[model samples]
Target: MLFLTRDLFSKKLTILFLIILGTYGCKTKTSSEQTAEQAPALVKSPEFNADSAYQFVQKQVDFGPRVPNTAPHKACGNYLVSTLKKYGFSVVEQTFKDTTFDGTIINGRNIIGSFNTANAKRILLTSHWDSRPFSDQDSLVKNKPVMGANDGASGVGILLEIARVLSLQATKPDIGVDIIFFDVEDWGATEQDTSMLHSGFCLGSQYWAANKHIPNYTAYFGVLLDMVGAKGATFLKEGYSMQMAEDVVREVWTTASRIGYNNYFIDERGGSITDDHVPVNTVAHIPMIDIIHTKNSVVRTFFDQWHTADDTMEHIDPKTLKAVGQTLVQVLYQESANLAL
Candidate 1:
């Protein structure tokens, strides 16, 4: 995913999304129409373990930064595949090569694990697992690797914990759930605005969306998680998601509120973040929303320790993980129950 301060014009998209959504008033959605992605969900939601999620985050951090082509990256990727398979998921490793913004031909992998694959009603959950090679945001050692405790690992951790929880359940859900860990998402050149070239960042998502694991693949909707494991992380409804999947955004935010996570899932509008979800919605034509954190205060222009060396596990908060994890489980369980009905 690309990162920039509003001041960086030459290298940023200059997302004036506030002007697009913050100042504007939204029309009320009809209560009669149930959200297609959520109508089938059950009232009883699944449990999400914050301790397990935190351990998953720590496990990834123990491997050091998962920079592509490195030993840690390869080992971590293999670990993810093996772990998902252990959880009884049908795992597929989609590998591809792409040229980065700095003209480096890099290998990328999109690891997809499918549950209840035959179910027609499916929900896609995704997070980029690769850490940035250079923490350009760091004042010192700007070229060193980023820890990515929240930026990459946190989202994946929540999903992995979700997978673990599903596997342990006595009964499986009627609806399908697919979790994808995308690579090469944080390797874009900070000095270049590669968005103009249509190949800025998120190479794995760009590849998977165009050439999906399954031919003619489609999900009811997708939710991409990023920077979801920090203290006081606020998830504003992102602009691009509203444009592509307004119903999905509403469904997720409403579910969060219903489940007592209203504090984390704020109703305010967030900037148009260009993340993995963009490719899923655009290239694959799947309505997807990004549950990502943007600058929620004047003190910090980004999430806690974003793209910096400080994005370590110490800054991670279990409560934040619980909020995101529990909310997602609620949505899925609701879907599962609704489908059975």
Candidate 2:
């Protein structure tokens, strides 16, 4: 009877141990699930369609050189406005006038489009739409206008593609997006011209900075794209961008590195350029960065075909466009994820 009692006690102890172990395992699983639920999931953005972006670029080129005060320029501006409206954005055509370095009165139109207008948290994307009035950098066609396939149209094409993709989504980003196509960006004075006004370049940006489309309009940050579709392009960290918005530059560059575009976005420092971001940063009080392709070896700190008649589809690479556009989309979605957190 004593031996039977001993065996019975041992069995009871074994049963208790098994039950405790099972309860512990269940608690651990529940804890893990709770932790996962607390963490925000990665938001996946839409795939950037390089082919569509390329087609957009081609459409602008088909309008011929978009020099200010020209027929092609006006027609292209109208198309841009209509396209933004078609993509479900509230469009604003900010019309203004500015005098060029040569004292020529030019009609400038800063096309602004807004997505998710009610959201106070906003991101701004910008590009110059006007082509250079003359190909001063081309030895063969110094007097002819630049086609601006890469410099002017590439950035617009990418942004337009982004707009289209966002419009198709049932649930949009957590933040608002604003696209501004600045006019009269390439009508500055030539390098050899001595009668240059200090405010000769970036006239459209300057005007918009002073008189914004919306009163007291502000964004978390702004990014300006220039010459981003060149083949074998290398985008060094620009100087003015680093000085004005180092955190944004670091985040953007880190994003590029995280997504296999580090080859295009180099880690080196580039010279400061007097681009549209300057006025946006200083006058408008918005921290803006320039994602411009710069090479010290090239004249005017730009690509080989900059401000030249050769600035055409021949030099614009679809791979380069994909790299930039994909990186931007990833950044936007990632930002949305952060907002969720």
- Give the poorly placed runs of model 1, Cα more than 4 Å off: 1-42, 192-195, 296-299
Query: Tens digit of lDDT per residue, candidate 1, span 1-341?
Result: 97666578643443566445545535434453434344543477668999999999999999999999899999999989998999989999999998888788888989999998888899999999999998888888898899899999999999999999999988767789999999999988686585644447788898999999999989989999999999888899999999999988988888888778989999888788778999899899999899998755667746858889899999899999999999999888877776666
**What lDDT does model 2 reach?**
0.89
TM-score of each: 0.86, 0.86
Q: Write the per-residue lDDT of candidate 2 for residues 167-255, one digit (tens) a residue.
A: 99887889999999999998987874545534488899999999999999999899899988989988988999999999788767877
Backbone collision count in every prediction? 4, 0
lDDT of 1 at 339: 62
Whole-model lDDT values for every prediction:
0.88, 0.89
For candidate 1, the lDDT comes to 0.88
Q: What TM-score would candidate 2 get against the native?
A: 0.86
